[model samples]
Target: MSSDTYDFIVVGGGTAGLVVASRLSEDPRQRVLVLEAGADTNSDPRIKIPASWVSLQGTDMDWGFRTEPQPLLGGRSIGVSQGKILGGSSSINAQVFVPCNPAVIDHWNSSLGNSGWDWETFSPYYAKAYTTPPVDDSLAVKLGIDGWTGHSSAHGPLPTSFPGNPSHPIRKAWADTFRANGHYQTQDPFIDGAQGSFSCLATVDPVTKERTSAATAYYHPNRARKNLHVLTNATVERIRFDGEDQKRATGVVYNYNGEHREVTCSKEVILAAGALQSPKVLELSGVGNTKFLGKHGIEPVIDLPGVGENLFDHLVNTTSFGAVDDLETLDPLILDPSVGEQAAKDFAERQTGLLTSMGVYTYAYLPIMEHISGEGQKRLKKLLQDNPPAPGDGPDQIRAQAYYKIAERGLLDPKQASGAYLSFIGPWGGPPEPGSRTLTLCVMLSQPLSRGSVHIGSKDISAAPIVDPNYLSNPLDLDLFAEHMLYIETLARSAPLTDLLKHPIIHRDPASDLTDLETARKWVQKNSNSMWHLGGSCAMLPRQMNGVVDSTLKVYGTTNLRIVDSSAIPLMSTANLQATVFAFAERAADLIKEAWSQK
Candidate 1:
């Protein structure tokens, strides 16, 4: 092999890409190379401070991709923020570290035809990705985390902690309100997929109060290893194959510093460019539908039609209410510039106050039927009965039918959480009053029935792919999301939680009054936005089922090529995708190690 050749070439030095590179390079004999299109922003404070996450979007650190106008969202073009920095979305995200509903993972194996991917087998990888912060006795009781015993793991590369002031009234109020409603969590969510309210974790180092991104946790620590090499500002155009008939990825063609370059890999090529861009890479390399490739003037290598299909993302709608005057919300941070100085001082001095938090401390995963009324329940049942899964035996239809069956079962089951709700301690879509604070309730559809696609618009790799999430396109999705939105009103009006808000319920947006199902539906159509938890563009299942990759994360009809990112997740997780993405990469690294070790 030449000096430029390595054992493995990993594309997109993002969250999953870093994890795989770090793990694969553990053996001294193996040589690994990582190509990242974005610059290394790991040292930037905007990427380090937990509260600075929101500011990183639209800056140099973000990809700044926008979705096509959706008819359901009043024809609005939503901004899809992807991290273009070294850590990828993990560096730019809000840092909520939550797990997928275990039941959903079970579906990946039992229903999606991916063996050894069940919750029991995949759960261990979650433990391998992060070490949970310890909860003190007093804080545990206050946060309702006392019941969460004997579940957390103390070993992992990433550090996870509960962000914000532990004694913040919102934390106790949230837990008490859920308990009063008989919806308090029964077990730790990390260990069991229980549906209830609880305080969630963030990827923040407890000691340093800095963001624990994949770059900081995985890459930075292992970067000194001689076997590992990383190139930043290197944009991979496509995979370089051995030949048209062989279909083996031997190297990659990337552009760096205004010059195109090629580097060969002796072993394997891993694609971790994320859900939005991974499919673009595969399609550009001639692994997609021949018709689509030919349209872009690219010759075909493998005729895989599922390269960019089955796109899934969580859609969220937020409603903000006025908070009590005494409560400390993040509103002042934006409204008052002086508050920023104090926050900076407080963080520098003691690692406390607004700088240490993102003002989103509480979360709940609840079943739709449990929150809706009897009439609503009947209506939901009728909706499901009236519109069954798409009828067909073809690959795309089969995949859709399988997802519909699983979604239907969970939608009806009281034990399953169809909606993920969280409380943010500030106004979300509207401005706050001069003398008043705000509390925003975000209601998200955990499992969406609608599917979309991301495909290349031109042969040029620099051009962004066309993204259409097709959010709320399915009739059931609109109705189901409306039900969840209506429930948010109930939660806000409920006990202890209501105490945190002002009397008479002063809403940030008067139109957000979710009085009835119809009103809620109208509000959702206009207000809902992407949660940025995109996945499944390159799913893992049988090839006949519109699966780009198989159970082993290997692309079909191709050797030495695999996808180890959110793009390969068949079913989107229940809540935030960072934790799930971390676990998935951890498991993929093990799988890759096992595969090559045998050779």
Candidate 2:
């Protein structure tokens, strides 16, 4: 086989891989090569346009993987759309840029046994990844960001700004409604963890009105560097490992242009193939559970059994209500072909109109106790106490105990947010009635107790992995999520926000009429879908705790193999995964540089 050599070989030229490769090539001496299984569609309009995010799904750019039939979700298979293009999911996500709770990052070290992974140590990297747009006084008031100060980052590769028209009334209405309910944010969520309602930033460039993704921010600008090479449509089959006792990744074997090729890396092989595929790559390289590998007639180089365990994702249920006719919403763009044509024309000429935003502006992160009834709170507490992690000493049991303890404390704390709610000014789940407008209220479980897995389905590298998120599998998850779902009705009926909506609210989906807790639970069981914020498949924890990687993100049984994507995130982020993934890649780059500087 024809072969090439480099200092570092990065698998999957997606979000994290591009960042690491770009950073490593800055030295002008280290040769770095990135292999991506999908084609480079960075210039495609569906990826660049802010409102065209939804249209990218099921296209060539999307992997279009679906979960195994979820029993709790009524035997329905939820579609998980992962990006199969240059920038990965960042190129196709809804672009809601938000942060994880500070406490969750702290838990990575204090409870999960990873040192130097706390909020203080990890927060700076968020600034290193993106530059927050300047918010003027008038715009701040309109966007409910008047009280925020010193939260904007002046220097970064990715540009973020508030999407949509500045005159949109829904923005102020959401702010005033939350303020009236005494749930307005006290501080900026980006600077410190706040549990109240506030406007969020989007990964869209204000000047260009285009989506600013990893390919646009990190790769395109640095592509001119001579030492950095990125090849799209290249699928890495497995890593080539050497060393008798200690397996060290030397390079990789990949398929390109229908031909098998080999490339040698002298320093390391970095795996950044995202949450679902990163673990598959490790397992394919003979690094997963020995018994599982034996089933496929493949020998295992490492006996580590946690390559695809502890999968985490945010499941969301959306409730849409009829909006007043006078209010402007995205419904016109969908229901009227003429309106969509005008919107496209406006975007082409002035970079304005319905095409500029995804219609998701306001967000609220709330504790379960804030919305549940007093009796419900008592039941939740009792339920938690009654089910204190299974009694055992095995690694799985110990991990479960640690996770449960943290979840229990956070669920009870008034300051910690357990659920996230957001507002969308348009129809969701189904098409709207002719000439009728709508607004969607989306509720998501921020910290779910239920865990799932993603594993190799067969020996072929082309086959999709078996992903089972086991949504609502934990009883506590259902109880807490139902309460949050019930709160949607209260939020929609609240004062200034209600003025935008019609009286006797007409739901887009009849099942979304959550009148009581029981109805809410039933709706959730039938309607909840993935937010696509997947992570923790190859978790970073101690080996005894079934951790696939260590604190430094190096594979547990390999010296030179490392993972630098959402897959290595020990916990799920509270909101969207884009911001956290960018920050993580920035930190991972520094970790790689620091490790090699010592050598």
Candidate 3:
């Protein structure tokens, strides 16, 4: 029996996994092990250079899972790619690091009844994890002073900053455009207000111009510690239970170096696999929806019906226009050999240029509802009036109900769910034309009324999970998308945005007045895409609500087992999930530490 034993075994060496492992091993005596099914990509160039982010998708670094053909998305099978590298999605995702709406977190505590998990409760964790360069004195207030620990400094190691070299001069114009449209403008995106147009902060070092991923930020610094062991290319087959009762998790079975290996955990086994794969992992371990287990010919160890349900994410609809002038978009710099050579030389020599900026560093958290025309509002109001209660009593259906209620509230209040997320960055693939510059207006749905599911297609963990995001299944979500789409069309043609554009109407034809809702809906249907903000597949609701985990982040119907990733998120409450997720891991670590200390 060639095996190893540890104090804790964290499944999935991704963002949350690394955070938990590093924190737990800080005790010096605890032995922490991290099992990752992907290769360590610290040396990957695509990961370090901010501009090369788009190129990493669909490659070996991506999990490459596509949704079941969405009935609402023109029957299209959209890709819901997960990160398949050491840092996980953080290593592959765009470097946009932003804050979650405080109200949304408050909802999880007050409205959804998740105690000890609110804005005030978790603010300290966020402060403990986020660090910025050229430190702002006001950030001193963001450093957990809101009554949690009286007062503290921002001591966490993760660094977030603006573009190292510089941003395009147009950033001022972008800020002016938001202000012109009556939106609140901010110097820093992570603000107490949580709504407004602001210059975005990237999870990159200001000096090196490299992505500050979970591995780089949390794990690598602590790698020299002997208590923390990271096993790359290690696939956890299933968690082993202490007994046939399946009440307690004892260890895990994994395949490493072409051989099955077992590892015992003296204290606990936490599953930090992301939303997409975490539920599948539970199902494969016989701890999911009983009916699903029966259908898949797996013995049901626990009837936790919520393990792989409640999948949802922001559905982004993008429109790219031809800009009159070059805007430092990655297209030309990487697409053209001569320009790419210069970019490479500059990056290596000076750590600057097009490669440093991710092309887009500003995000407008717009209150799209207020900006919508009377006609659009009237149409949406009538539709909301007619929306039937989401049909099933199942957990997924209950989640759909909660999602709609919150989204409806957001329409009336920007502080609740942000109205929409807008960013500019694209000229993707090939340029639209020769010597043509590009400007992409990305409008993202902050609170989608859609619910989907993920289940194991095979007992094999290596096989892709059956993902059905069921996008736009709820007409209301589509209605919001349409409304925002039409609104952005107007913004693109407005004074500030249009004044800066070389060609206003090149890529888009806002010819339609959108007197009817269907006109806007048709346009959005043509251009909708996932924003890669996947979560809620394994929610943390009340047990009767089909929750896979509880507010304490402990798995329902099981002891010594927990899932501490986006999978446990009750809803997608943020735009970019990295900041929220890192903060979440910090909080979870405290909870685990408390529990272990009591033992």
Candidate 4:
């Protein structure tokens, strides 16, 4: 083999990319290479510290793709962040490790044509990807949480653990209120797809109390493999195809250090770029919709319409409440130098402090039916019964609604449905004054009936793609999200939680009055932002259904090319995407080896 050639080339050194690269190169015979556009995090304090997760956004570490003006959000162009660092969004995300609702996965395979993606089939991959810390009996008792495992330790690369210090006065208040309100049901997301609230874990190393990103656990440990190679600061220009049919992907052309370079693969080319960039690579490589390709002056190769369609993301609405009572948020840690220094010292010395926290220790995952008003529920059901698919959407999206019907039945009858995922943010996105206290609630409606697109607006590869998430486009989605926000308002005014906090600090003066449905609906539209769980752009299904990839994860008309990231998820999991993406890559790794071992 030549110096630049390999048996496999995996693009986008992100979470899934690293997983696939590491597993594929496990064999001494296979040569694998990874191309990443961003620099490695390299023990950067901003990235290592759990509390600094939000600070990484908009920095050089973030892809920072601003969405097209959402007409529904009063023409606001929301910033959709994709991690430009080694682990992709997993590196910058909140690090919560909740798996999707089991029924949601069942719905995917049953109705969405994704044949083998059920929970039972994928559960082992979850155990294979990461190991959790054992139940901290002391902290568990204080938090009133259980179901913790992984202390005996498994052999997975990534680590999952409760923060050495996850407790806050506000955190306890929120949990107590949820329980007091009868909303806190014991549905352990990891053990079962329990629909109600529970304590969750984070993707952080237990000993070091540092963020255990995909790069740290999956890629760095395997860096010394002779068959594996990683190329950082290299951006994939386009996939290189073989012969006139363009059926087989030979390698990729990428820009590294101001020069365009090509690496050939004897076996296959895999694209593990996250949702936003993977589809752009497809469009740039001439594998997207016919009209979109022609408009960008790129000759169409496969004309697969699903390459950049079916875009879905979780939109979050956050509100900060000010408390004048005996609340101790992280405000002083950021506003006062002495407190910040003390936190840094504690983490460095004992690996224990507020800095070790993933910001959110407790969260709720309940059926949307639990939150919606009776009138709203009837209206939502009627809207879905109407079953209106968006204009220009393909068959896979129509199928997604069918799966929703399953969940709808589960909700209406004694079955399953999509969830409204709400996580409490202690200390808020930004700190308040030195002595002021603030509590933030991140209200999210995870699965949406709304569908959107991601397409390259310019022929230039570096230009940002047109990402129209089309948030709140579906009347049902808008209505459901609004109901969830109202439910949060209810939580805000509930028993123990209400007693802890004073009042919310929304844009409106009369934040006290969120009772009116229309007023609350408008508040959600203006304040909602991407939860950063963007996916479902290049769906996996049959070709006739306008699927970009098949059940095997191979592109419809191409050979030796596969998408192994968030982009290939046919239906967006109704939870944080990091754990789901990790398991998917673990499964994809096996699929890749199976495909080639026979060859």
Candidate 5:
């Protein structure tokens, strides 16, 4: 084989690309080349420890890309961080291990005609990619092993441990109050088709207490493979194609060491450049809508209309409250050892420590109740028949009434929270709304109805794309978010949590409390931002959807071109996209192996 050519040229040595390149290189007969846009992951300490991630933002290792001003989010530019290193964003993300919701999968399989993506079918791939941590009986009992990524706890590579910090009297009292208010503690949060409040674990090493990322899990152990060439500080411009047959993706043109070079792929070219860059590559390659291409002075190729559409992200609105008279701000014993040596000893001996804390210990999920399920429509109707809203009260008021009823049961404590944490929902797009207090309650609007596109900024491959997410263009999304905010308001005014808030005098701007609806709308417009979970710019779809790739993970217009990255998710899953992305790569590897065998 020539030095310039290989069996596969995998673009982007991050999570998905590295997984595919590693698995493919297992066969010495086939050569795999992984091109990365940033440096190697070896020197970054932040990449090694899970808790160290907060320090990595805007660093050289991160792409640190900023989005165009969002109209819904007060026209503020949101920050997006992607690892430019070998592991991709996985090298920098908080190692939260959550699963794709079953409802999300069913929507993909049943509605999108992607047959193999359903939960039952994709379960094996998830298990294949995951290396579970060791867990004691207590932790395992809390996070069930029945249907999760195999109970590898006994001898798994990853380490899973609960926080060892003994619950403070105030913390215990508050948690107890939560139960009295009606919110019950749950065992496992990831059980199939289930939602509940439970303590969770991060992806870390049991022995070292370090974060376990894809770069470490997949690439570091196999760095010596002769056929595997990993290049860093090199940016990909676009896939080169033969004009005679625009469908064929021949090779890629990239710049490394300040020089331009063309590399050919003997068999295939796989794109794992992620959600934001994948579509930009396609547009640069002339595979998107001709008009959009022509407007940018690029020649048209595949003319796929949906190449850069369907952008989705999550938004997080976080507020901290003084739930108890004693401050929970920072545990001196845990954060700084000058106060206590026992805290450090506990953290070192057992992986459980104060640093392992997820500020918000409990995360709850509440479905929009008014949209009654097949079983609850009549019950809702009957309840409404007995106590209907006043003649002119809108659906928001009706929903607010139901929200208050649920709040009475006490799952959420608004007052305990210093402010609202706006977290993005999943599926499509999201919306924004107005509220009060130093911290206002808000929804992530993870799933939004608005669609946006991504196109190349110029011919320079290393240059990032022009991204337009068009956030919060849907009214229904805004309404749902507003309903949840009101529910939180009710929760904040409830008993136990209210006591905590009274001492600290949590204040809100008077502007947020306007009686006129339009005035309140302005406040919401000035304060929304993204959760930074951007995806679906290069969606996987059937031929009918005019998608970029097929179920086999192969690029639609080219025989040897495949995409194994976040760009391939047809629709955003309700959970974080990282874990699901690993599963996608795991499954893509199997398909690639099978296709290779046929030849």
Candidate 6:
């Protein structure tokens, strides 16, 4: 067996791993090797064009894993997609670029006991990762925070902006309605806070309007470097532990080209294989809970109880509409020339304008939107109205507790054995709103109390993890989701919105009983799916807390092991995970550089 050695060995040359490798190798002295268990980025179109990503699901480029039947979701197994390619999930996403709320950053910092984790310290990295483009200068007034963090108009490799047509008429109306309702329209909320309506930016080519993923930003730029070697189609089996100290991860054993190979990391081994795979790698290498390993007959090296604990994800349901005219509803505007000829032509010729827009652009927050409303509200109130209140608890409080448990473990129907609870939502808002084309009441619960696991399905690194996000395990979870739903419904069915939608309204494929509460519950059970943001598996925490890695991203038990991807996030952020993930990866690079400088 030929042994290859490097100063740093990075597993999974996706987003975070690539950033680490690129930044480390930039020193031109330290050697960095990235091992990817999937394909390179160039061949995947679903990754390049923002609109084409939907088709990429279940393909080889994606580790299409399904959950253990979720009782809350009608006993249905939800599909989870993670990129099995160089750029990772960033190569394939809706490209909605939003930042975490400052509160979220502060909470993370306080929990991790690291001052550097705060938004102020982490803000620069966001700037370093992308170049913000000029979009309707109208954003200055609409979006309050203009001068903070990476929200500046600084030019760089990654392009950021909204599509050229702010006149989309629908979006414009929606924005106007939000403003009239007193909701602040924010710009680059990551800079100020994710609390209002704002246009998100994507990492794309400034001239070409193409996505500038980790492959283009990191690998492609430095492919000529001799110190950096990337191996594709390499499925890592497990890490080779050093019995001498038991805390040293000396190298990795992997299956390459139908043969087993071992590669050594002299200084350190960083696992940027993401949240799901990282924990599985640790368990397979014998670094997890002793009891669980004993049950599986697998030896336990480190008794880290939190290896797969603290698992949570974002759940979202889509409410799409068919335009009254041939208004190109849910159509591919980037690829189809007829939709926006000038912008597409400009993108083809230059790389700017709407051609650069990620199809699903624009975001707003309904602050007043409560967790429940409409059909389910009356039903839940009636069902639990007579149920004796628990020890001084009010009706809302009692109901919340019940719904939380139901959502956390997943509701089960012993008869049909379908366990899940659904909350009712309303369509309250209507016409006169700038961007109000249709009403969509989204349900997202915060701080899920249910615990789940992720493990290696087989030796194939390309194979997806056995993921069970266990939605609606707690009864309170349902209530919180219901609160958000009802809030939106209120806006949809309110005076203005009601008047606009007075004509024939759109309805979801009904998934509930005839009663309002039953119908809402069934709808949620049948429709609730993941937003594809998976994290908290290889969580970042102090060593004593059973955390996988430290604040600096170094693994807890092993000196040579570090994690720099979304998996390292101890908790979920307020906004989408892309910008934050990219920022963290970039920050990890700086930390790595600083460490090498001291050495």
lDDT per residue as tens, model 3, 1-599 = 12489989999988889888889989988889999999988678889988888889899999988989887878889887688999899899887877777777877876665888788787777667878555445442232111111222455778877663343544555666666766644334344535666666788887788888889988999999988899999988888775655478989998998999989998899999899888887888889878888888888888887777888788777667767665555557645789888988898898977788676666666655543567646665677778755588875566657667776676665334444555565563235555666777777888777788888897876788888988888777777777777676677787666765665376633433344558878866765777778888778788756777888888877778988888888867658778888888888888889989967
The lDDT per prediction is 0.89, 0.88, 0.75, 0.77, 0.59, 0.62
Task: Give the alpha carbon lDDT tens digit for every residue of 343-365 in model 5.
Answer: 34555576555444322233334
For every model shown, the clashing-pair count is: 0, 0, 1, 2, 23, 62
Superposed Cα deviation of residue 379, candidate 3 (Å): 4.1
User: Residue 387: error of model 3 in Å?
Assistant: 1.3
State, as a TM-score between 0 and 1, how close model 3 is to the true structure.
0.92
Question: What would the TM-score be for candidate 1 when compared with the true structure?
Answer: 0.98
- Residue 350, candidate 5: Cα error in Å is 8.1
Q: Model 2 TM-score?
A: 0.98
How much does candidate 6 score in TM-score?
0.80
**For model 6, how does the per-residue alpha-carbon lDDT over 1-599 read when each residue is reduced to its tens digit?**
13398888898888888888888888777888888988886545446655456667888888777788998878999887888888788777666666665555665676455557887788777778777776545654333233223456554445665543333433444455556665534445655666555445566554545667787777888889988888888977788767445488889888889999888878888888887888888777777777876765677777777777657787665332222332222333423457556654665676544445454444554332321335544544443344322453543343234334332222221111011111111121112122223334344543444445676655445566678777877554454444444344444544333443434544432231123434455555667677777887877765544566778887766666778888888666654678888888888878877776767
Off by over 4 Å in 5: 138-194, 243-246, 325-361, 369-443, 489-524
Identify the runs in model 6 with alpha carbons over 4 angstroms from their true place.
1-3, 112-115, 136-151, 154-156, 164-166, 243-246, 295-297, 321-328, 331-358, 366-443, 457-464, 493-504, 508-519, 543-545
TM values, all candidates: 0.98, 0.98, 0.92, 0.92, 0.78, 0.80
Q: Which ten residues in a row have the lowest lDDT in candidate 1?
A: 369-378
RMSD of 1: 1.5
- Model 6 deviation from the true structure expressed as Cα RMSD, one decimal place: 8.0
Better-scoring candidate (lDDT), 2 or 6? 2
Better of 1 and 2 by lDDT: 1
Candidate 1 global lDDT? 0.89
By summed lDDT, the worst window of 10 consecutive residues in model 5 runs over 423-432
Candidate 1 deviant stretches above 4 angstroms: 243-246, 370-376
- Candidate 5 accuracy as lDDT: 0.59
